[model samples]
Target: MTERPVTQFGPDFPFAHDDWIRHPSGLGAIPTDSHGASVAVIGAGLSGLVAAYELMKLGLRPILFESGQLGGRLRSQPFEGADDVVAELGGMRFPVSGTGFYHYADLLGLETKPFPNPLTEAAGSTVIDLEGETFYAKSLGDLPSVFQEVAKAYDEALESGANYSALKQAIRTRDKARIKEIWNPIVQAWDERTFYDFVTSSPAFQRLSFRHREVFGQVGFGTGGWDSDFPNSMLEILRVNVTECDDRQRFFVGGVERLPQGLWRRAPDRMVHWPKGTSLQSLNGGALRPGASAIRRLPDGKVAVRDRWGREDVFDAVIATCQSWLLTTAIDTEESLFSQKLWMALDRTRYMQSSKTFVMVDRPFWKDVDPRTGRDAMSMTLTDRLTRGTYLFDNGPDRPGVICLTYSWMSDALKMLPLPVERRVELALSALEKIYPGLDIAGHVLGDPITVSWEDDPNFLGAFKGALPGHYRYNHRMYGHFMQENLPPSERGIFLAGDDISWTPAWAEGAVQTALNAVWGVMTHLGGRSHADNPGPGDAYPEWGPVALPD
Candidate 1:
């Protein structure tokens, strides 16, 4: 048999959500009496939307509540005059390993192309600038020997510190037992460690100079610099690497926001009890309710959610897909709904900062090669400067192109948090000028610059969850909340689903997987059961759930 490709099945919970959703048996069935039962879905983000969409197909009425726009982080903002040219302000690059997310994309028939990440053929060329030195390369081999050394050392460290090859092979083949056997112990061993700790302490890295480590951080192997995530958990980084979350990435042709929008408007052909023409959009009256301001468990055992306009609605089940921190800061959530330990996990979830500044150019001017150097005017850039990572998007010669002047995270992101879009573009151009001297980057610009500082957005709080050292217990609490049979009755109906609630936070696949978990939870709560042939995440979860660590 051919080996299955690596997917985000689980370093934590090895459930095949993609297959479950694709099953012809169709994600279980609810009783006729429970059909059309109301469920509240907070935040119309990817997770919330996925939960709502699946729930709708399961014959549940999902009332979507959103304080922000339809697509939460999959925001694709269009330039004023450019036809269909968009600046993806959030969740731009998606990896092919994200089969769960792509399942929906395929359902919607959205087109995708390789994202122009540094050193990939999609990028055409890559420029790395670090500590006042700049080097151009089309591939890793073309860079300095030090870069090759750094890449080799990191690979060696992965093999040395973790059973990298065997573990990845198990994940690829979907060997549930072997996956748990290898990954569970690693979780226990490294749950207390940070990514920085892993890198600094690894014998392979220790053998190299600190400069090598710095280079590795500045120009990370797959995407770009990961120094921003240096303080994050080693487990988090390992999950990304093993799952190939940062490799072989692609972006939606029009924009990723089309995904959630497509889901909202799509009428699934295989819906359970709903009419053939019904969709989440049609069910919710073509618009979502206002953002939920407060949530309380009523005396009658059902949950009541009050919208921003003081409209209180009751639901048999509620799924909260907002950032976990919003439970404390924005929403007035009842204290008794979750155990104090679970509340602690929600409150302690740390989110990373991120900023992106984009400008629409008249054409793909960056593709123009200079006769003197025989190099494109500029290339996908990774630098130590505030710009951090700059990506170029070419939209055929006739159409306008987009330039993400800078995509920075952590401290680098925070620097641009206070700046206006124009100022942000100016700062990015200044940084780029240092790399592409005498190039007319400013002259190619058309339309107003677009930018976003996710951390500054109250709705998001931060870009995505970045687990810190010793946060495994917290992650376990959030990720496994959907499997709540053993929990007290008061906490049973409220399910949590988001990338943050998933082991691999920041990846869309996490959101998709967790959403499926919530769908299973809600289905079961509503007196539904999966078909014997095709078990849902909840059915498979007991034996294949995340390994519990002693608190």
Candidate 2:
């Protein structure tokens, strides 16, 4: 028998969202009366666009509201005077395990290439600098024995602490019962514990020195340093590993922004109640409406969404796809729209800080090899310094190259948040110069640098959600709210979707999955039902939903 490949089947929900979206029978059918119903989708990000697109396919009209850039955090800022050359300031890497997200990417027929992650073949060479020491390697085998020991200890920790192999096997085979059997207990045990707690308490790490722990954080098992996430929930880290969200990563060719923008302009080959040439762009009259400033439920049971300009429109349903905090901060959402418990969940949901600095260069000079040393001019770098992780993008020999000088999180991100873009580049260059002495990186730079601090923007206070210890119930409340059967009539029409509303918060797959959930929620709310052969998340939610804990 062929072994089933692993995708983002939830340890929490365990629904095959990838399978659900790709079903030949279609998502669902709306009632004839609700065919042209107006559904307000707030925010023009991945989640909002996806919900809008799917709802349009189901024969409903989706009105999108945008306050900032259309792509939201999937921004790909192009350098001046450069053709198709871009800096992926946010959400650059996509792992193969994220089948739910790739379903849409594939639908758009976007081209992708393997990302240049450290220690991977795509990077060609990786440079590891820690505690003022430098080491270069082509693979993990070339690193020192300490790295091997750290890697092995992490593996053992997973096996001894989390039943790594069996649990992953369950996920790969799509065994919902077995997955919940193994996962629910771990959630109970680790929900209140931090990632650092899991590492220090584990027998494997206890056998090793604290230096091993530091090395493990500075140069993590996959990608790069994960010390920033050490303060997050152990459940969060475990989700990233078990689901392979950090493995076999790839990036969209032109830019990741293409996915959402393409979906916006794309006209589905088959759609109901609309003309052959209809599209979200055409439906909205070639542009998105202004940002939503307020949401209020009408006496007639319909919802009124008011734009920043004070123009109000009534809709049968509204899907809030913006950052959960925006509900309290940016949007004047009615208190009666959600229960106090859910509002607590939404209000308390924590978001992490992230910053990226990128510069376009004259060419991919880093790929050039020096005659004296058998090494390339520069390699993909990981360090414990302020720069954190530096990535290189080679468009082609004849085209301009792009370099992400620093991709930092939390404190590291905060350090760069106040600095100007020029200073950010100078500091990154200063850090790298020490690692590669005499390397003139400044000489190869060209055009102006582009940087982003997600928290600095009013639209998005942070890059993505980072659930803390003891937040599982909060996550459950927000994620399961789409199945609104028992909710009072007052709150039934308003729904939520986004990465923040998902179990795996930092991943685009989470955004895609939750968006599909809102589609299911909106359809069912309007007296529609999924095809019997192709049940939606809400259909299987009752039997395979996330486990709930005591209040």
Candidate 3:
């Protein structure tokens, strides 16, 4: 079957740059530095790569260092050909919301596509009842009402009988506008606050609204799984920023990794220190993986590195452009003064237990794969009552008989199960076959399973830290937290970057911000003029939403 490109919607929404993107463009102010400057970027994931790419634009020859392949969360495991269009084992699917990510992808030149039909047409099924060892095939669009129905029953219990309103302010309006004014605000809040807390706390839940229970009805609504103690408020933040789209709507074009892939191909020469399997011991005073003396920080600051027992080189300035947790841990005491404070911020953080399950199917689940990627991992929630899988995606292959596998995210109770790799694979395959009944998913031959446990990966304990209730206003202040304090350009040389420092929390978007922050930090530090002045200081993702109520 021939593939057709789906139309994209509002900017930062989906199918980015498809004339539908509505978010504002421009990086808000990341100026280029003087000519021929040296820079070192640590961590080769989206954040590190973006930082390096941005540095190149700034006239600084930037070098990127990593212990693994590029794309950190955005990377995949081919287990085969270099360009066999590797299957994504990491980040997948972009939410219509999450403006920062959308904004960053567009800037880097990635395209978006529309969603699929029957919805289940993409994948024969979407639900796997692992708890009961059952399979549930259904469209997620039906979710909103599903939860509403369940909430209706829960509402009755919360109403306190006659003259009793579960809503805190004693108000109720189903109107979208009314909902936006009243309910939407509530939704936004609950979304960011943490579902567990909101479930346990929100007066609204006690008062119950149609939206409250409906959230769980939606696939990811109870995303962390209704069983989770974590709050939905944080997820709500990502939701609030997302653009709402119609059902049978998704996208993918010329391959989903186009943007990041392009950035790499376009500036391959600029990327340095891209070593595979050469893990670091620690970082300090502008140096990476101290010990063995395989690292060289040249007089100009261009980091020259070798494998575990390789060679050496130099670099001018080092842009710690990965996750703050990794960078902070690697940094030795003295040189890393803010370690304690940064560690505090990290400590205050929380994250959902999520895992990615990449499956190579025999054909396009839908007529086409969505161009955007994020939140495709399989998940389970309450009201919406999903069976645990949260998302799915394409393998980026164009062959006719190819089974472009999808990466599903499992959070909540499902993530807690400490099963072995073989057992996990069997469980995932069983789940896939059950939910996607009638599909030749299991029959599809070839390829051993390749998975990365971000939820368990030692370097990163979670798939990026989550901001807890009331953790904001200062959360991004720490991780991905950008401080515009000015210093001479030279003094700004040691720049701290990474998605954690950029407020986007472990996503590519945050990485871009960190790059801008680090370089901008350097500019201000140098006393030299930069492209755009600090609009002030602090994290950038929007903050106005209210706590979320479990749907």
How accurate locally, in lDDT, is each candidate?
Answer: 0.93, 0.93, 0.43
Stretches of candidate 2 off by over 4 Å are none
lDDT score, candidate 2, position 523: 99
**What value does the lDDT take at residue 416 in candidate 1?**
92
Compose the digit string of candidate 1's lDDT tens values, residues 1-551.
78688998897888888899998888889898999999999999999999999999989999999999999999999999766799999999999999999999999999999999999999999999998899999999999999999999999989988899999999898999999999999999999899989999999899999999899889888999879989999999999999999899999888999999999999988887899989999999989999999999998889999999999999999999999999999999999999999999999999999999999998999899988899988999999999999999998999989999999999999999888888999999998998999998999899899999999998998999999999999999888888888998888899999999999998999999999999999999988989899999888888998888998
lDDT of 3 by residue, 96-170 (tens): 434444654666566665432222455433443433333233544544454444445434433432122322222
Error of model 2, residue 61, in angstroms = 0.2
* Structural similarity to truth (TM-score) of each candidate: 0.99, 0.99, 0.62
Q: Which candidate is the best by lDDT?
A: 2
Better of 1 and 2 by lDDT: 2
